[model samples]
Target: MTETMNNVLNDDKKWKIIQGDCLKVLEGFAPGSFDAVITDPPYASGARTQADKQKSTRQKYSSMGDNAPPAFEGDAKDQRSWTRWAAEWLAEARRIAKPGAPVCMFIDWRQLPAASDALQWAGWIWRGTAVWDKGNSRPQRGRFRQQAEYIVWGSNGDMPISRPVPCLPGVFKYGNPGKRIHLTEKPLQLMRDIVRICEPGGLILDPFAGSGTTVLAGVLEGYRAIGIEVTDVYAILAQERIVRELAEAV
Candidate 1:
């Protein structure tokens, strides 16, 4: 749907989902409007094979094939192209993020450099990275099974940002022990941890809000969240998930 036509849901204190292209929706907001940003963007893991697509859509969590790659395979025409795309989104993120506000981008090893470079180019100073160890027991064939992901944190160089919690060192282990609705969906506990550490109150933004996990975390934590998703199917699913989460909260 066009940005103008996308629906914006208004609920109690919770941030609602906005269905549209993130770049377009974000352009309409004032600069430095968000307190913090916790997002998981697409890793550009290359084009999905028809079989890959089918498997992603149909396989149960327990039934995924051995050959299936991790949700994001770090796909791009080249490293340069990947950096360009990341730069575009990150620049916008910097514009909307308050001075010294923390911007957390979730990524894997393959895309970490590119994501970090984009953040630097967008004027955010590199602070540190957080490792989220997803407790998965599967073993890989050639390499060690990746049980973790990274979150790069940065802030605008010139301003004072709020640090709601003390920064913790070492990796954070989060267990995901159930069926998966969205491929590459992060656990809710992970999102909650990030939110708690960042302490975003006015609004939390997630550009690539797959399945609405981040938004749900924000809502549950008593912060308004704004998310953008390209696919209608995911947007619908995210909304449904939010409804269920809200219902459970009551």
Candidate 2:
């Protein structure tokens, strides 16, 4: 590692959760400094149906958009805009991640194709996708249940030589963690499983660390974690949640 890179990652046992725009914060890191990038960004501010063009797909997912919790900033970009926005940060992520470092992103089915295209456009190889089967999806009368979320994971360059001891499974079957601090709060186990893709001692960066599940996962697994959240409330929430989780573990 270069002197700059070493200085940036001087501590390998810390979890730093900063509140700011990820793209801007990402620019501060040295190139090839991170070992992995695992995150869940807004999917083009979500895909709205024709009937409810005003409301975002995420808003629609919440109960009729009335009692929906406040979504984070930058969740209103259209597909094209989001894809382009994704490329900017993704390119920065690729720049900071080591060669062959893993990149994992979460997106719903509607935005899967666009996300894959964006990842490739950002210069990462489209390795393949994994399924996060929620098992119990909302019931639809005629159409199939929306039971699965897609995870687009790839590598920065060639595959890494350091393999995981027990390979993690691709299809995650973890159930939801029930009530959420964030609208799209993922289960901690899901993030933990994803973090395992990187070596245990390696550093993981999450630009869209809503509620800090990904950062918590990295810290819990002995990997240093750096998370940037634009929303101030969520940034505080993430830190509190991490403390609470660790306290409960003890």
Candidate 3:
């Protein structure tokens, strides 16, 4: 085991935020160390350039330009790159996740296939998919207004499985309250649902923990969370959010 893994094994804290590349940090964890995995990673939607500043300005009259920072610039281009990256992470997750542990990954419709393929290739049994319908979504120029995202749930082993809850569906609806810090911050309710389904009190891992939504959910649900964030800004924001949440709980 690596020094980082050793530290994690030694610590008994309920939550931790690790500022580093997920690929590197995942290497430090031992196989079957975590009980669950929930994450929202970059969609690799071929959106490298910043959004049009003028367009953004026109839409919201905000000082920030229309062209938001490219969320997937550091990663490779195309779905193939995303598939490979996700597969790599899933491989690590599978190793660190307990038998029959659930792994839930968030993705947009455009990238769902690749995400599913990546998870299957990484040895997870593709159980089913769930949808998050954000009621307050923006109007789309073409096609139906895109208001829904997806969560692909997989398991570490293949066998008869029990539903995490007595009654849960593959789809759910939530309001898009907008993100406070991260570009693609997931809703708290969504996180809460995932935690409820997965059950609490075990170590939950979020490899691409943007803005710390998953971590916050884990903390609130009484589960130990370990988050890895690539960007320094997001890392700081996640840590701040965790501290604030913990303080509020007291």
The prediction achieving the highest TM-score against the true structure is 2
What shift in Å separates residue 232 of candidate 1 from its native position after superposition? 0.6
TM-score of every prediction relative to native? 0.80, 0.89, 0.84
Report the Cα lDDT for residue 99, model 1. Answer: 74
In candidate 2, what are the lDDT values of residues 1-250, reduced to their tens digit? 2463335445533777878998888777778889899999976534465345446534644663656555676766667887999989899999989988999999999889889999999999999999999888779899999899989999998985656636668899988778777778888888888888887688899999889999888888888888889989889999898878866876
On residues 1-250, what C-alpha lDDT tens digit does candidate 1 reach at each position? Answer: 3233223435544566767777787887777777787899876542344344333322423346664323322233355776887788788878878776778898887778888998888778888899998878579789888777899887766435445655555477988636556777888978877876455465788888878999998888878788888767778788898899789889
The residue ranges of model 1 lying beyond 4 angstroms of the native Cα positions read 1-13, 46-77, 140-143, 158-162
Model 3 TM-score (2 dp) = 0.84
Which model is ahead, 1 or 3, in terms of TM-score? 3
Residue 33 in model 3: shift from native, Å?
Answer: 0.3
Clash count list over all predictions: 5, 0, 10
Cα lDDT for residue 18, candidate 2: 79
Task: Kindly report which residue pairs in candidate 2 clash with one another.
Answer: none
Residue-level lDDT tens digits of model 3 in 1-250: 4656736633457788888888888888877788789998877553534353213212322233545422322433466776888899899889888888889999888789999999999999998999898876568677687788999998899533464544567778877545456656788878978866565477889998878899898878878888999888788888998899779978
